[model samples]
Target: MGKHSKPSGQSGRTEPASGVRVRPLPVRSAVRLGRPSDIWHKSALSAVVAMAVPALTLFALGRLDLIFYTAAGSLCALYGHGLPYAARARMLLWVVLGMASSVGIALTTASLTTSAELLVVCASLIAAVHKTVFDAARLGPPGNIILTFITASAFFVPQHLGQVPLHVALTLGTGVLAWLVCMAPALLRPQGPERIVVARALDAAAGLLRTEPRADGVRPAGVSDAWHATSAAVHAAWRTLYLVPTPTPAKATARAGLERLLMRAESVLGSMGQEAEEADRLRAWARGLRGGGPLPGVMLSAEQDVEVLGVTGEVSDVRRPAPCHPRGVRPVLARLAPGSPLLPIGARVAAGCVLAGWVSMALGVGHPYWAVVTAASIYQANTTLTWQRALQRTLGSLLGLLLYTALLPLIHVGHLAMIALALACMLGAEAWISRNYWLGSVCITPLALLLAGFGSQLPARVLIADRWIDTVVGAVVGLACCVAVTNRRAADRIEVALERVAAAEAAASRLLAAGPVSGAEGAREVGWARDRLAGCLAELREAVEVASGEWWQRALPDERIDHAQQQGHRALALLVRQVSMPAAVV
Candidate 1:
């Protein structure tokens, strides 16, 4: 792989590629079972607790009609579990407010008009907004689906002008409770999120260490994947640790211990050879991070502390403020620019939601909002993922219909029974959805149906028939829009990503040419350069994966991409060597 020009005379495969290959439609991978999130119980437990208290209270008061509003608030608990306490608190605040605002808008719109066409347009636009904002913010997992679901459902509910505030108030109030529930764990273990992230870095580094070294002076098949995964984990650990405030000594000490563990993991990653003992030690320390008893004391001497190469200056200082990267409102506004790639996704969501809802309504489906949700849920970063979601959603929605039918007997027993049953479904949805959307959908579909029957109970036949129709219509229409809407900017993003990697690599090269770095200041600069290049390479990989499946996009410069990645990683390896083995000449 040459940098200036591709293999001109010859055209053939030579080296292993690092980016995730985009298959047309990965049906098996989409439907396949996978490991759950490491902290699945956090979201699962919080969602149940958040719902049960309010739902049971409403049930006792004969106010089950307001269950939807409280449920909307309660679902906010499902987010921010992976963030540090400081970050999580801020994130959850915005999420709760966003959820309430979404529902409030829906309620307001429904109160103003009975026009289905108008409602469809409003819902689609809101879905687009939710999708766009959530992606720009990079709030992981469940994405905008929950917001979409609650908002769309609200639009169809019978609303009067006066009642909107009360309903929205219920949502905001329960959302407050949810915020508390999620933040409670921080009190028990203030360093919980930081510890978990470090543990993850350790595990990822250990996995990389366990990879057998290649002897042919050529890249191995899975080595790049392992390398990128390890790199991402290590960087994520650093970012999370940087976000944690260390105002007190105890907090500072906990932060320091986690930093040492992370440094060890990063060192292991920088060392390209297999070290079985080192890998075992990392895993041991990772396991020790399970509970909040004590930090894993991976001590570093004063001399070793200066070995903080490949770190940002702010990160080099324990008391420094969070990184200066764009966050909160600024980056989100920038991402919402007209020419942004997210615009196409927003376009897809808007088109799909409207079309799905319209078609469902034309068919006289009982609840067309379900179809709207199906459309909103399927739009992923690329069309390949969108197709997969369509399939998984279809399968799960159908299975969930069956589950709902079985539970109908018990649910009809009383309002209390229905409330209990709905809570169970909520629990299962959060727990299982972490592994695969469809598995969770099996539980989720029923929960939605039960919630729909809240104010006025719909018959089993009507509920089943309505949801089935919506699911099929939504999947077909949404997938059609995904493929039809052209995303011409996908390839362009890859190009920009490539340029970033090139610039970062150039800076790193300049640092490498400065001979062996010494002193805290010089080493810190080297570390920052390394981190910049590593982050750029990671972005390039993401851009490649995203562009791979886009329709009607410019042909990707595969050779150029491969060359950049290979050369960039080669530079990184040398940079790591310079940092880790200062005595060895590159």
Candidate 2:
């Protein structure tokens, strides 16, 4: 995609033994709109309320100038929406800490120093750390953008040593509030998050079942996408259920019921019985799960229920399912270890952010943090995804400027008007961002402009012009850094992923060879193998897809990877069938 990209050999010829095939940027899907999340309102409402409470408090005290600090905490509500309440609680607390820490760092830096150059350096490095840590922790959407924005802006915001503690305390307080707002839903429906995901799994599995089976009963080849979606959704649903901590007897009972529903859903997805009819049943169950309704039940004995949860009650006293900690700190730490792809991305972020911020400062834009944030937001999983963000951010910023221009008059009417408008845009960004980043960006741009209005007294035209210039500068510089920081290790990651697939396939094949055995225990063993192989294949596919987009990576064995995936899936299907028909085998 750039000057740094290594040329593959002649077209239609074998690549050099050391070379991997680079994937072209998929521009179409990058900008394409996707279906909105089923529970998007959870986030939209959380953000609006989170922001509104603090805004109102500030307005009453005539301390709206402190809104910038509070905005950092309010945005914390945006993460962990999809996590199980048990896991969400831990993740939200970390998010709260991360938000405060990020703000504190920026505020401290600004107070300790007055050099714009030094601030740019400090903010750039912080942006890199934010990018790396958040990606590593898997703290989902809004991702590091909001955190980076708050930190970068805090760096530029005028701060004095005396008031540093006050600002950080304000942010810390609001972060606690954001955490409360996010966890409030758990009080009403303890398993609401788990139920929603299970229903999504049912819906996705139903899509897979909607296709007609072949005469020989094999799945049609073209329905792989549906199969993949179903498998991923089911996998996620199972994980969510597993993550539900049963601290109390009541919570354990709720989890047990959820496990039954998920098993039924899984069985329906894997069944060979009337596809259309099974699909309808799955959809019916899914609809029933949408509210505080009774869990759709399946006919399973107490022993069978225990088995399906991957536990052997006979050995429950001696052996138990391994515990998964709510705070997933291990993976977070691993992502920063030597040879991680995220490290190189962090390098790109540091370099790009510094360059972008420097250019903006040289250009005399009052808020170079905008440029730093623009750069930070553009670095996604791969260059293709990064390119998409750049396009989205630029276009969104332009359209957002137009939006801000239109709303400028109302914003000028009074403080109440400005506050109301900012709240609406905050709500809109969360509502639309899930569908597509750019759509959210349109609302985000104006929201940003208004936040500036709260912080400084810059004229609307200067804010508009400076934002436009900084955006263009940031996007261009960020892309350059992406090209410059080529990750050759991407190919290595794909190779490792392929090895995992081979290992999983071999394990599943050995289990399938054991023949279908009697009882839930045997069935559970086979089911475990099936899930493992499916997961490995999913990872392999992701690794390949990400590597393909890189300009520099070792040559991929395309035919070998395809064969591995095909064999892996075949093994998975056999395991699934054997586990589903667990009775009467050798």
Candidate 3:
């Protein structure tokens, strides 16, 4: 469904040597959005609880003027949803610190210069840097976009040099509280995140199995997409388990069970051509994992007879002694260089924010940062995704404005009531954000309006009017930027990615061709090759998908991508079999 078919020679493209026509598989559109997954619910809950703590505390203390700062700090909780407890702790710590730094900088800049133009320039630069760091680190959801929104919006908040320290402290203090809230769930279920990851992998594998095959035994369309997703989930599950700082006895046992499940999933993929009942078994196991029940045994007697290799524990132990080096600023700056693929995206974001902010101020909007945030929200990996975001943001904001108008008079009755309503909207926004950006935007719009009006008590009508105006201005400006700043290097990136994948596949194929290895050094080499091939395949998939979505891009190397992916999956399956039965290959 994501791809389209057109006659191969329609655009002056040569036909293949077989003398048969082939269709170029171009992406249908870049605007594909999916429903909310299970993890999204957890993220929404964490955000709500985290924000409520500081929000209600400040409200009780009659310090409602500081709610914006607290809300800004609470945003730190929205990150690291997929990480293990130990890894999550480290990520959240960095996120909270980063949020505090951004807030401080914004407030300081506002105090130093009353010029809106200067503020826009500063915010734009910060947004670019924030986007760079977030992309480099691959810090998942509530990603750089939301962080940029919070910091950029802070630029418009009136600030004084005397009050800067107090506000920064408030943000830092509440940020710590938010961090605690996000991590607190780990105590209740230490292995919960890992379990979720394995469960998702199992579910994805089952989905692949359920796809009907064509007469030639090839899987149905979109099977590649499903396989890609399943592979990612499996890889993430292993990484999460291995990265656990210190696993308790129970967690260790759980980890062992998950390892077995992973092996079973790989076996299913290896035996995809056969009509096996393992698909149902995998689905049942997934359900059991999600439901926290005892896992059922594999029904494939012959497959089960294959030794469950001690691969998981050994790999983790061998890797544990390695020192962890934090990524340095040099690499991040290098990524932001003019020649980098992401450079164009970051540049567009900066330009859009600056121009949108200028337009908002020129139009005398009360909150120009609203326009900046909206502009930031509309950017995605490609122009098509950006277009989708703009539409979703505009629609969501309009509906959100309606909801805000209806509830504003009621909320104004008391400060506590307004705070409560804001919290509720924030919770809803997080809940719906994963389902659809527009749905999430509806909640975010009102919540933002409420928070913006908290200390100032701007009239609801005025707030609504300004928001509508800003939304249009930001969306228009952002879309214009998308059209103007095209990623000219998208096709070139796909070719580079294909070369990397080819190299990785060749290395892996050589390892398999050599048969089972003896000695630690040989085994390590094999394992490294397998891991490298897997990572390269994932990168290729992402690169192609993104490039395919760009407007006015050259035809993608669809056949090359498909062939590399198929070879990569086959190599992985062979590696899995070899690990289980070391002598089988030879």
Q: Please, what are the lDDT tens digits per residue for candidate 1 over residues 337-440?
A: 77788889999999999999999989998688888999999999878768888999999999999999999899889888988888889888877887888999
* Candidate 2: RMSD to truth: 4.4
Candidate 1 ranges beyond 4 A from true positions: 1-23, 214-221, 299-304, 307-316, 319-324, 581-586
Question: lDDT for each of the candidates?
Answer: 0.81, 0.78, 0.74
**Across residues 462-528, which tens digit of lDDT does each residue of candidate 2 receive?**
9999999999999999988998898877767878888889998998878877776556666556556
The TM-scores of all predictions, comma-separated, are 0.91, 0.91, 0.87
Q: Model 3 over residues 32-149: C-alpha lDDT tens digits?
A: 3457768876777787887888888887888888888988888787888888888899888999899999999999999888898899888988887787678767777778977788
- For model 3, state the Cα shift of residue 377 in Å: 1.0
Ranking by lDDT: 1, 2, 3
Alpha-carbon shift of residue 201 in model 1 (angstroms): 0.8
The list of candidate 2 runs beyond 4 A from truth reads 1-26, 212-221, 272-274, 300-306, 309-327, 519-524, 581-586
Ranking by TM-score: 1, 2, 3
Error of 3 at 149 (Å): 2.1
